[model samples]
Target chain A: MTARGGIDLGGTKIQAVVVGEDHEVLGQARRPTPTTGGPQDVADAMAGALGDAAEAAGVRTKALGGVGAGSPGIVDAGAGTVSGARNLPGWEGTFALGDALSRALGCRVALGNDVQVATDAEFALGVGRAYHSLLGVFWGTGVGGGIVLNDEPWLGRGAAGEIGHVVIERDGLRCPCGRRGCMEAYAGRGALEIRARKLEAKGEKTKLFKLMEEHDRPRLTSGIWARALDQGDKLATSLIDEAIAALGVGVASVVNVLDVEAVVLGGGMGVRFGEPFADRIREAMAPHLFSSDNPPVFEIAALGDLGGAIGAAMLVA
Target chain B: MTARGGIDLGGTKIQAVVVGEDHEVLGQARRPTPTTGGPQDVADAMAGALGDAAEAAGVRTKALGGVGAGSPGIVDAGAGTVSGARNLPGWEGTFALGDALSRALGCRVALGNDVQVATDAEFALGVGRAYHSLLGVFWGTGVGGGIVLNDEPWLGRGAAGEIGHVVIERDGLRCPCGRRGCMEAYAGRGALEIRARKLEAKGEKTKLFKLMEEHDRPRLTSGIWARALDQGDKLATSLIDEAIAALGVGVASVVNVLDVEAVVLGGGMGVRFGEPFADRIREAMAPHLFSSDNPPVFEIAALGDLGGAIGAAMLVA
Candidate 1:
């Protein structure tokens, strides 16, 4: 039986997986990303990870059908290169990423944006396969999204899925990308942390104050907020509501324009918030939809943390 | 030389043009739309106008290559039919509009949404041809836009251009489409008129007060507002600025998402405000762009009101 491979070269971690043709995980390995590595070193680390996974699984690299890697930033799919990725720092200006990875794994490699790779995993094995089209939005430290049309990722010019950077507010707050009122600026984890810190500095009464006391510098987690809400804290609940509202607004805009069937909310935040958060987002985003009552059914990611790994594996499959 | 025919079925007027294979207009004709007429009656009137133009140019029906009609609604380009149109009431459920017109003119016909057709025109022959891709925005009673990719209109799903319905504000202003805070609700001319009437009824001080007195009811117009602004009316200037800012924000969202090469502004209002308004929008939209200065250029339509007609001709050509 043929085996497929997946490689996820993220900002903080590197993961690779070897899977059977049925998508069952045969072997998997992960490690922290190299802090001082150049693009070549990063590529070599990715190659080593793939080798370890394949060796553990006793899978022949030549038997692999496809290899898909999820890297950061603007990926030019046609040129098989990373055009620009700010998060990775070293990978910029059209690195022949796919070629390098293909040579390393001795298989055809399809390089995609990290978020898009995550979406691909969702489409292949998550709740997305049933739908004709899906918009997967990942709300984490930074917000990122990807679109899957008919089981294939729609990589528009520059492999763009910058749904997070889409401006939601006309004259709202500034974003890290030097834009004002982008969805990321308001709804990203960073934005939520900033809001929470401001409230704390103002001496507001809340469980978040206690949550901050428990953890150094608040850690600023969506998971922490979800826990606070579960414990029935009003301030935390309001913050969750605000986050959902902002995200819902962004999701609604994408649904109205794209006419997708389902919107799968992935990433650490989405997984931590669980189905209840998904429900709140679904309700919040419903009124703004152009389609029928059944518009886009919001769903949590089926793969969870292994979404990038699973999706990356499928890239090879 | 064979001639290609083009028709623009607007709400109030029907415009037709006879063009050569090179897209040069051989002859053109325009007539008021029969509001009380049925489908066949309207088709006959449009065919008569086309025939008049064709005859004036000494071209026979046999010498014509094909005919293209650009109307307002969800045009099924594959089937050459307009399924449903809100502007043209009762025109719903897959009317073979192109077939009807083709039979009337004894020639083959192609169909497209009016805004998309105009966008195609700009992409094919107008200023947009200089660029590989663009976003064509038509600001009429309601705003509509089209995406031109690789010199052809990229009509996703049903209709080609529905940029007006893109939600700018979630749960803000009530849109006529039963949505909230769509670009159409706040920036459309219809929305502007609605706002002007409400303000006038409350006795707001402005030059529009005097203009409304000249007309029986308060009517908002780009011309009237231009004239009022020329006379140093602060209200008119502010309203225009407000509308332009909203449009800029919307266009910024589009540019950041699509990353098109240029944005061509057309229709009645777009041409009226000219380059000054276009410049302001370009400046406002730039900050939210993905590639900074590498974002789309702002351009005015060179075909004027004939953009749709010219684009229709290119469709068949």
Candidate 2:
């Protein structure tokens, strides 16, 4: 009957929430991630956020069942530390988030990849709840995926469902991770915007070009992409289709390896374009299904971005 | 101090061995696989082989810790059956190998996909024993891999590890599994033979062609390929390099996700080619490694094909 707290420490935003045993959110807070802060500063910021939520919910932080934080990058679950995160500005290796946060909140804490935490949240309380086996994919700044098997997180060597780095092209574009043709390099939101901007600079006749001209930026935003889609822009559709296909390859690979029941798409970009985008991914991935009779069903995350914070809380139970 | 029995069921041979608590092979028996027989007949033959091996080791089949089986195809471990297989002629859709064998031998039996069982065997008993994480790859008629995390197999859903079916290209080559651009489509031994035959038919000069002329067949066997490598055939080297590179993509993806310590290569092709092929895989996969400081170590399976049979025996334990 006690409550648990969850924190999602992302590159851009930090979200904290307190959830009851029934998985209902008691209180929540969000703020931008610290830019020039060390691990101590980041830990302090996380503590403040958690305290604010706890205070709003009228729950003592020490009385909470547990706390779970999902961060970006390689995390040592056993050590409960952020080993190395490249996306965030200064967290290079082995940030003792668990020890720091546990000390601050007076409870046990678990850490997971942010995308994986979102997936866990979805599997526990969102669209993935209906399926015993699910693959949760979040396509935002980078592509990330998590696998839930039999309603429990399947953390394989702390890397169960990393669909983003799955290679779709042998020698295609180089990725920051030093891999070529990874889905993250082609299907992530950043990739979509980069492609749109390239087309715009070349004076391409597409709705994306016009939107970029109006925004006066090299990259396209999710809203701009949605607007372009609304205008029936063929170029935007084509680029989105390519991104969906790439994402499909990564998802299908997971299906072939894991044979999960459903693939739930979350993150800012994954659910932004809505049902049409999900349909495109399903259509592209159908041919590569594990078996002819039964393939993975694709769905959108019900809790959306909040899934990560929810999953973080769910980790306690 | 209990002992277990393992069996590696291959098209040409059947190997049964008793492994002690320390993973040492106490006794082993090898026999030819009966090609002219029904499924039950083959099952009986395999049972007979194991019974003889157990007797030779002075252990009762029932008293043995466990029996494990490594065979080709989609295996349903829950039912201890081979659900479907492609390479083994008529072994399709749930053959009760575990049941029939257990009934005959009077012992509990565990069954798994051949590649997966071997991976387990290697992870527990071979080169992979040195690492907390590993991916075992067996390259032969088809390329298959199994994930080993902390010496345990990641048997997700009904699927274990079917890395061969991961599609690397969207529109490249058609696979027998009804997928396009799958890693197996380009790197499987069948594909290699097909590529070699096509090149020969197109008047490409190479030692492989010469060997084919000598054998009076258009197809090249593993032995022939070895001879070509010995002769320093440029075309053969190029083909081998290309195949290894493609296989590296799959391995790299696994490493990127699993962050495993080693990749153990088994099967005849992998073992016969040995360090040469393994070095190439390591080199090709290195650039795709996630960290510059450390990369997964690639090694030959010390247990060789015996890994399947050894892993099979450990199943009961």
Candidate 3:
């Protein structure tokens, strides 16, 4: 029985998993991402994680069929390098991640961006299983998305499906990408925090700041936001509403142009909010649809944290 | 020699052409559209136009291998019927246009929407020939567009490439399609004329009214607008600028999402303004592009008036 190795290399954490031919996870390992050691150090951590995962699965690294990794930022898949990943400190410029991983594991390796890999996973074995065309949106620190067309990922001119960068407002909020009015600038978790801070400064009644202070965290996590919403926090609710509306505009444009059959929501924020958030997005997107009578199906992603790893493995499967 | 028949059925005119396998025009005919006689009358006119074209080519209708027609409105290509064609009176609901034309011409028939067929023509033999992925935008009475991905038309779900309906402004201008903030609401010829009339009623100095009166036309034509712009009409220039800006936002969103290799501008307004309009669009779209450094090539569409006919023929070829 052949086994495949997969890694989801994120900003704060690196998750590695070994899966068999049936898509069942044979073994898994997790570790804090090394930010101080630069790209080489991060690559070494990935190698170690893969080794541990393979050992736990009772398989030799050299015996694995292939390995795949999903990272953050603009990835040149052909060159096997990642660039423009701002969240991963010391992880800039072109890094031959695939080559390094392949050398460490002694097998062929493939690479893709996190959102793209997650989308591929959803399309293959999750909520998007029934649709040939789909748009997968993941709301986390930044709102990112990927598109699958005719059972293949539509990577136009190297960098397609920048749904977060789609400008919803002409001259609205400033995005981290140096663009104004991008969907990310409005719907990202960072955006929500900014709004929360502003509303607190204005003396508006809210439990978000108090909760954050109690936890002693600089940024509110998806779990905290969910808890606040469940507790009926006014500021949190309003921020979520704003995010939903902005997300709706961007998603509606994608749906109207691509005419995809399904839109799957994933990532920390998306899965945390769950059905309520999906419903809001569907309702807000209805008015903007060109074909309002026949809109795409909106659903929450099903793969959970294993989506990126599963999707990455499938890249070489 | 084998020849194929093509027809462009518009609201005011019916154009038919016979072309050889090499895409050379063998024969062509044009006639005023029959509006009073209903869908059946329009079908008869299409048959008559094809007969005339085939006779001029000195070929029997039965000898032609295939015939294709491009019509206005929502077309069910599989069923060969057209619906929601508001321009053609009594052409609502569904008409079996392909069967009607096939019965009359004694050959297999194909059907597509006007914009989709025109885009196919441009992609296959015109400005978009060099690009594998393309977005073809046609500015006329309404702003309609078509997308070609991997050298094939992307008819998503049922109706894809509805770029005009992509909402740019939140609750902006009211669109004829009962939507707000659509690109067509601000950039279509009908939208431009509506703006002109409103400005004129506000006592603004403009050459649009003068040009319309001089030509004895109720509505301003593309040529009239072009001449007015050349003659230094402030109103016309401003309107064109506004239209270009709105078009840029909508187009930039598409480019940001799809990352097509090229964007070909065509139809009455696009051709009339030519390079100047294309330049303005490029400039306005730059700021909104996610990949601004490597933007898609913007070009004015070639193929002139025969684009629809040529594209239709290619559908069957």
Query: For candidate 2, lDDT tens digit of each residue in A1-317?
Result: 78999888865567889998788989888765676767777888888888888888899899998988888778877888886676565777678889999998898898877887798778767888788878888877678878776676766556556678888888887665556888888887666666666776887778775686797643465667778888989878887778887887777876777677888988778778778888888888887776646777788899876788888887677
- C-alpha RMSD between model 2 and the true structure: 5.0
The sequence of per-residue lDDT tens digits that candidate 2 reaches over residues B173-217 is 876565788888777766777777778788887888678679754
Best by DockQ: 3
lDDT-based ranking, best first?
3, 2, 1
Whichever of 1 and 3 has more TM-score, that candidate is 3
For DockQ, candidate 2 versus 3, the one ahead is 3
Cα lDDT tens digits, model 3, A1-317, are 59998998865467789999977899988776775757778888988998998999999888999999998878888999987776666765778888988888899899988889989999989998999999999887778788999999998987798888877777778887778888888788867787778878988888887787787655676777887898999888888888999998888988888999999998778887889788999998999998898999999999877787888888778
Question: Alpha-carbon error at B138 in model 3, in Å?
Answer: 1.5
- Candidate 1 at residue A30, lDDT? 74
Q: Each model's TM-score, in the order given?
A: 0.81, 0.81, 0.89
Better of 2 and 3 by TM-score: 3
Query: Which residue pairs in model 1 clash with each other?
Result: A6-A312, A6-A313, A66-A316, A67-A316
**Decoy 2 TM-score against native:** 0.81
Tens digits of per-residue lDDT for model 3, B1-317: 47998998865467788999887888888776774867778888988888898999988878997988998778989988988776576876888988988998899899988888999999989998898999999887678888999998999987889888887876788886778888888898877887889889999999988998898655677878988998999999998888998998889988988999999998778877888778999998999998888999999988866787888888788
Order the candidates by TM-score, highest first: 3, 2, 1
- Chain A only: give the TM-score of model 1: 0.78
Among residues 3 or more apart in sequence or in different chains, the pairs in candidate 2 whose N, CA or C atoms overlap within 3 Å are B5-B313, B6-B309, B6-B313, B7-B309, B66-B316, B68-B312
Per-candidate interface DockQ score:
0.34, 0.41, 0.70
